[model samples]
Target: MNIQLNQKSDKPIYEQLKSEIIRLIMCKELREGESLLSMRALAKDLGISVITTKRAYKELEDLGYINSVPGKGTFVAKGNQTMIREQSLRRLELKIKESIELSRQLSIERSEYADIVEFLWEE
Candidate 1:
């Protein structure tokens, strides 16, 4: 339950919170059925409103990352590797595409780009 909130980020606080939780789940830092700190507790810890944390948790549930019980608490949803892979690949593809576009904008030659990728690939 380690989440960092930045007041100046372009992304909304709830969205940032959602993304960080998802990353933690994908990295196996959060395990299935593991309980999360209560929304009120998290809000107090992060110095944010409880409603904001609720919205973020709601979205995480919507995304199938966690499950909420009526009077209990939120727990990590069971991992589905296929689902995780699809979600993860979508994020990664966008990042790689952005990098490629930036490289092209800088007028880097194709050969130089390929060589650089190859170097990183072996590392």
Candidate 2:
């Protein structure tokens, strides 16, 4: 719930909110079945519009990351491990691809690129 929005960034506010929530869930900061702030409350806290929080929450629910209960509130979904894992893998793959492209641009050897990866992994 310790979200810091980059108001200067080009990304949409709702997307930033959604991504932070997802990051919290992935890091186990927000555990399964944990209740989240209501849309209006979150909007007020973040100094954003209620519609922005609503859109982010709605998208998260559609993606099975959270669930909303009438009058009860919204809680993290309990069975999204597979989806979360897949999302993590996809992000890793994208980073790897970007590294590979950078290496190619710099004419770095494959072994050297891999060594950098290994070093970073250990750190």
Candidate 3:
């Protein structure tokens, strides 16, 4: 419900909306069965077109993040723990890959990298 749209971002508005919704759902900020604003309402609130919000909602539905009920409204989908874990792991993998590349570029030893990771972990 607290989504921020960046017009200056290289990403499209719909994609930005979709990603923020997914992140909120994964983080449990949007709980299962929680209702979301209608496309028109959200669009008005965000000052975006209804089509853009609709597209983002459609993608979220397609990706199993939310479900739409015709007269009732859209609600968060249940059983997202596995999907959340997968998302978290994928993000961590990307970060680790970046760290490894940086380590190589700096000619850092494996042991030193391990030490740094350990120190960071305990912090």
Candidate 1: list runs displaced more than 4 Å: 91-123
Superposed Cα deviation of residue 123, candidate 3 (Å): 21
Tens digits of per-residue lDDT for model 2, 1-123: 899899998999999999999989988999999999999999999999999999999999987789999999999999868777797688789988998999999999999998998999998
What would the TM-score be for candidate 2 when compared with the true structure?
0.73
User: What is residue 98's positional error in candidate 1, in angstroms?
Assistant: 8.1
Task: Please give, for residues 8-109, the per-residue lDDT of candidate 3 as tens digits.
Answer: 999999999998998898778999999999999999999999999999999889878889999999999877579756866887899999999999999999
Error of 1 at 37 (Å): 1.0
User: By descending TM-score, how would the candidates be arranged?
Assistant: 2, 1, 3
Q: Which ranking of candidates, highest lDDT first?
A: 2, 3, 1
lDDT of 1 by residue, 1-123 (tens): 778778999999998888888888878788888999899998898998999999999988987888999899999987685786697789789998998998999999889989989999998
- Residue pairs clashing, model 3: none
Q: Among all windows of ten consecutive residues in candidate 3, which has the lowest summed lDDT?
A: 79-88
User: What's model 2's lDDT at 100?
Assistant: 97
Candidate 1 Cα lDDT to native: 0.87
Spell out the clash pairs found in candidate 1: none
Decide which is better by lDDT, 1 or 3.
3
